[model samples]
Target chain A: MAGTDDRDVRLVAYADGELDEDAARAVEAELATSAEARRLLGIHRETASLLKAAFPESRYAGGSLPPAPAGRARPGPHLLARPWAGAVAASLLLGCIGYGAGSLWPAPIAAGPSRMLAEIAEYHALYSRETRHLVEADASEAEHIRAWLGPKVGRAIAIPDLSAAGLTFAGARLVALEGQPVAALMYTRPDGLPVAFCILSAPAAGRGMLQAEREGVGVASWGDGTHRYVVVGEAPPERLRHWVGLVQRQI
Target chain B: MADESFRQALTRLLPRLRRFGMTLTGSGTDADELVQTTCERVLGRAGQLRDDTRLDAWLYAVMRNLWTSELRRRRIRRHEGIEAAEAVAGEDGAARTEDRMTLAAVRRAMDSLPEEQRAVLMLVCVDGLSYRDVSAIMDIPIGTVMSRLSRARQDLHARLAGEADGKVTPLRPARRG
Candidate 1:
């Protein structure tokens, strides 16, 4: 009564049996006095009765359930034991894996002749190794690494100077990629965590870069007209952005 | 104790549960899938069901959530596989001849109602659940449940009435040759 409308709300409450003892008496008294109120009550009662009458009967009569579809066996122990069932299951699993792999990897032939594999392999090689002072050039000389690697890949490659990123440059490396040469730059945090940057010429037109993650490692690859670059590391995605931005500006 | 009781309760409720699923989905196949998924989810989280008395509400909530998610996923996949046939014959024409249009329309209307309204209407009208039982199942104050039921009835009445009115006036007449 406090939050509800007096007329419409009271009738609804009365209809739903929500009116308490005194409230019910008051409503009944009102209904006796007001013919219109009684009519409203009648309509409410009729609507409620109609709704109840229209209520759908239970579809699943205890024993009237439809038989399982033809050839679609019930999920019993024997169903799983059947050779055909096993074959069907195996085929379904294989189809799912194949579909996922096809979407992810695409046709290797359609991937175009590029240094993607070599770059990924290089990134894998350097970061996977266990050593200190593993980089040829220290983080302090970010400019030198950019200049040295820029001309070799036939692009103005800039080693994303990320000293502020809490990661120090471990230096860059020249690696053979797709019969042509490319650059693989390495970086690490003070705690000896590693990140790799691989840059080579871009693949053919209409080809998009791919990103993949495996075993907590994120590998992001992209290609501009001149060069394709992949940054592989265990750093948080934001840090990866910093490295990508550094490469983007220089290239 | 709760888990054992919940399992027993679910098994007992399975028949009614399947009926609710069938009414909601309008397809026996889809209903079976919905019931199976609901059972699996309830079984998987058996330990989390603390109150044996509130098992019906818990199961209904799980079923509702699962159905909503399944509908969303189906919307994405519905575009493929039948495109060519659907494109050749328009959806309206195809639906008109199928005898499924009325049921489909009813289902759509029910689905389009607000979740609270739909739940109340479904429980009270479809499942024949008493207002007291609905209040317990929804875990709502009985007054709130009553309000929802009132509003749901009004909305459904308006929808059904509008459909009837639209049908009374024929938009097209048969041509005499």
Candidate 2:
């Protein structure tokens, strides 16, 4: 069935820029020869854009959101707890690289592996100290988290229990880096020290842990062919490696 | 992570998520409810996120899951797809009369699509998600995503073209028992 009418499928792929260099060249070659192909390609592209314009975000923007749920603390203590103390403590314990909003996210980041890593490392630094609403799903809900996050992340989200490492499951949230969604599962020690494990949906070619620390925060990342996993926020690289090992052995 | 503010970021995403809800459930009320439920779910599951950003995609995933379960629970609930069309066809969107009418016609044509195809079309065409993104969100294969997207664009184009040419008359049947 597909072989009969997949010409448009290929055209759509080409239009969406999903086609590889060779496939794209072949399509362009055909487009050069066939006006019909050119027209179809144009129509496909137009229709796709028109379909988008039809559902403008402004059209759906006005509806009110439901009330905030219970148990979601309203950023209370973190506000009153001597802001400087929390700030100083966070740096002392974890020493996350990028401290401020978007200003001081360490220089060596651009020199990091990928933009996803740099951006996610920044996210870890920014939110690592968040005391309230720490996770979208609490540690208690770990059992079915894989079921909830697997399909969204394109694979099973391995929620590793780091209790033996004195790191409780702080929470997990689905965040995006550079427009692609990543699952950020956070863990914290009793002293409120944070460790984040961010998982990207895409697979990797090679396998090994790439460990680094920008200025303060530590990030150790690896891939298992299925998905790329990055362990951020742990210190000294050795402990980071240990946690990564625990995650690898478990998952 | 795209936007700096959390609440503002989520509020920014509501309309888009609501529009997607309209696509899934095909009714304004249901769309709102689904989006609201999604917000509530995200709040209840608040640990699911923090500052990494891309809340829009995550919210869409959460909303899609909520709607899918609601779809299962409701079991064959009738859909008009008009509410979605109307939601988009309102006066503010289209600048000129011809544009508005064309938009309305285009929306109706979209409304006429199979729910799955409409969804694929919306995500690809309207939301600008890649085929792989749509596949992960919809939990379908890339091949399935491509075929559905292809068929949907073809159907929509054909319907609109037929209308413009007056080759096919609009069909509205008498009420059935």
lDDT of 1: 0.50
Candidate 1 CAPRI level:
incorrect
- Complex DockQ per candidate: 0.06, 0.14
Chain B TM (all candidates): 0.53, 0.83
Where is the poorest 10-residue window by lDDT in model 2 chain B?
A: B168-177
Per-residue lDDT of A1-251 in model 1, one digit per residue for the tens?
54434565567668767678998888888888988778767756655565443322422323221222344323332211222211211111100101012121111110111123334544465544745645666656668867877777677766666676666667776665335555777777765457777776532111123333444555555444345566777755455556666655665
Look at candidate 2 and tell me the lDDT of residue B93.
37
Interface RMSD of 1: 16.1
Residue by residue across B68-130, what tens digits does model 2's lDDT show? 765555443445344333532335533887877677677767777777887888887788777
lDDT of 1 by residue, B115-155 (tens): 56666766765555667777776677777777776666555
